[model samples]
Target: MIIIHSLRFLIGLALLLVLTLPLQAQEARVTTARVEERVIVETIALNGSVTAPRTAQLSSDVEGRITELPMSLGDRVQAGDRLLSIDAEDVALQVRSADADVGEARAALENARRRLREGNRLGEGRNIASSELSQRETDVAIAEAALERRRAARDRLEVRLERHHLRAPFGGRLTHHDVAIGEWATPGTPLLTLIDLEHLTLEFAVPLDLHHRLDQAELEVRLPAGIDDWLPARPIADVPLEDGASRQFLLRAMLDDPPTMLPGMAVQGRLLLRNGSGPAVPRDALIRRPDGSISVWLAREEDGEWRATERRVTPGASHAGRVAIQQGIEADDRVVLRGNERLEEGQRLILDDE
Candidate 1:
């Protein structure tokens, strides 16, 4: 009876070991990376839009019927290029009449001067009276004043004639044009909209708290729909005043040789803050738990087998898929980069490379 009972106990122990060995020796396939000491520049994500330095709604300064529309919608124009021409026949006729009056005035002034010279010679010979010479001098003064008045009138008429043609104020592209030949254009009426695409900028509404950090931060921007590569940018100026509705402030930056971009296009920005350096690992190594605590799985070698160890870490700045470890991990420590999602403490790891 004793032998049978002992044999039964040994068999039960063997069965229990068989059941647990498979579970204990199970290995999790994973990939690993070593922590590196790098210059980690922290950054804040920003939402912004592309904008041009100059956008204008051009209009005619004078009222007239449009006789010539040199530029149409989507046309590029240079500074001083004629955009529209008005009917200037009436104004040109008035200028011509003024020019004739100026010529007549000059002739009258020359005649008056000749009479005054003769009068002075006659008075020196005592042949003309003093009162007569005084009258001659007064006539010359009146004639000279008449010439100046006529010239002033001609200059005014010439300016009016020039205003009949509207020229571009700056180099840009016409975005809006609705006027046609024989259409009546009046002052203060928008004829076309012009936008300068060469000098493009970016405008962002940033939180007020980050205003102080802008002085030392470098900016990088990318157009979400157009360019995927990040481009460097420099801060132009800030409004300094806050927007009451959004609780944010306006910040503008100039792009460095940006690709083709249009105003109002959405752009993403990263304001890089170069504060310090620390040990970092690929972003995939991070594991966020349900309790709002962040941790990482570190692979440690023990007894010639690689095992996973749960480590709580304080993460700082991140850039380019790598995150700086503020606390808990050391440089050169092996971190499980891939296949760490379901890892358990002290679980054996089967490295993919092996």
Candidate 2:
């Protein structure tokens, strides 16, 4: 009878212990997205600036005092238009002197030629000595050389006179004008800044890794403040030289139909490379770890329960809030989009249906 009582007491204690034990903890709620296969064209973004295709700083080619400056800042000018004029009085005087010298030389040449011709005729008649005829020929040759020298000097003087007036090298708008009437102008002194807006280019420095791909890619430019849409551009130049410090190569593109764009405006450039099909996931699913590596939380079934699995991935270009997974993750995989920050390796998860 004692044994039976003891057995009943033990059974009661077992029941109490079973009731006191804690039940399995509820699964944490999470939002998940299925990885999808998509066609993604990789793109590279580069910062650039708008620049004129042609720009020049007009400088004085002759030393003189400024006499005429018809164009001012913001003035539109055509090629060969007079931008600034310096006093050409001294150069003009030199030109006149040179002209006088050339005329004198020509007269001397003509006289020498006439004498030589007469001497030749006299020699033919045996009335002039051979030595005298030779001397006359020598005089004619000397006169011809002197005439050439004088004419060359006169041409140089005329060119100098023209240089006293600075002309526009191309059609452009003047942005700077530093010369004034009566201002002393010296050779190589900058007087005006001209920029051609009709042919504008977008310039950028891209990493050397993209040097080969630049030609094959389609480029677009986005002006931050002026234009609302991306402007299509074609690669104009890609300099092979690279910056030593940045390891970047210079690239320039011509805009197809730029609108109201100006030089020096900041712009963003996009280079779209070849189209590729790949698995893509929501951008929010990506997590950047402290070590600067990117990863995503994957919900995997284990022991008949959904558990979070950390996956290391290589991320490519992003579009429409979705990022292309270059590696590590595949299509049809459940990727946790929300409530993943607190996820742990193999931790149980409850999917949110809403």
Candidate 3:
């Protein structure tokens, strides 16, 4: 009877212990995500600026007084549109004079040819001397030569007249207008500055050591307006020349489909250098410790029960809010994304999805 009473007291103490324990001590709710295997690439952030493919200083090829200064700063123009016109009256008169000379030369040539034709006909009937016919033919040749010279002179004057008008070589906007109407324009002196807006390039000064990796890396650019999307860019030019002072080289890249951005606008870019592939998880799942170690909590299923396990991980390059796990994890592993901070080893896991 004493042994039975002792057994009943022990059973009561066991029941009391179970009721006194907190419900949280048994299981905790957690949010988890499956690990994904993907390619991991290292990225180098860069600060750069936008630049147009063509920026030209428009100027006249001939010396003259500016007669028409039609374009102002910020005027968009098409190719071959005249921006400035020089006083072309003198050239126009010269062209007219050359035209008259060509006409006289042509009339003289026609008369000479008629005489040569008459001499040839008389020579064929043995009525003209061979020396005389030859002389007539020589006259025709000399007149033809004179006509060609006059026509060449006329064409040259017309070209000079065209040069009096300064036209845009490409479609662009005028960034600067330095010359004014009635200003004495000289050859090679810039009158305006034009920047091509159709094609743009992103310019970056990258470290010399990483220059070689630019070809293997993918490039992207973003504007300074706090936009989230990155524009895809490709390397257009890598100047092999390096700056001695900065130890950097120029890298010019172009976007596949670029937004409207002004030249010289500040931009940001990144060079993504792919190294290898590995399992990755959301960044939230990572727990950084003060001791410079990184860890993650994982949910494991065994015997129809879920439990939590803390595992130390070696993190690699992170991209798109996910970090590649170089070690201590596998693809399809259930990583605790939320409530991982308060987790303890061997604790029961009640998944939020459940």
Which of the numbered candidates is closest to the native, going by highest TM-score?
A: 3
How do the candidates rank by TM-score, highest first?
Answer: 3, 1, 2
Candidate 3 residue pairs in clash (backbone atoms < 3 Å): none
lDDT for each of the candidates? Answer: 0.90, 0.88, 0.91
Q: How do these models rank on lDDT, best leading?
A: 3, 1, 2
Q: lDDT: which is higher, 1 or 2?
A: 1
lDDT of 2 by residue, 1-354 (tens): 999999999999999878765322335689998899997868789899988878898899888889999888999899999988899998899999999999999999999999999998998899999999999999999999999999999999999899988999999899988778999998887888999988988899888888877656888888876466777888889876644778888899887767777899998988887667899999899999999999999999888889989999999878657889999999999999998888778788888943
Candidate 3 stretches with Cα past 4 Å from truth are 1-21, 224-227, 290-292
Write down the TM-score of every candidate.
Answer: 0.77, 0.64, 0.88
Q: Which residue window of length 10 is worst by lDDT in model 1?
A: 239-248
lDDT of 3 by residue, 54-120 (tens): 9999889999899997888899999999999999999999999999999999999999999999998
Worst window of 10 by summed lDDT in candidate 2: 19-28
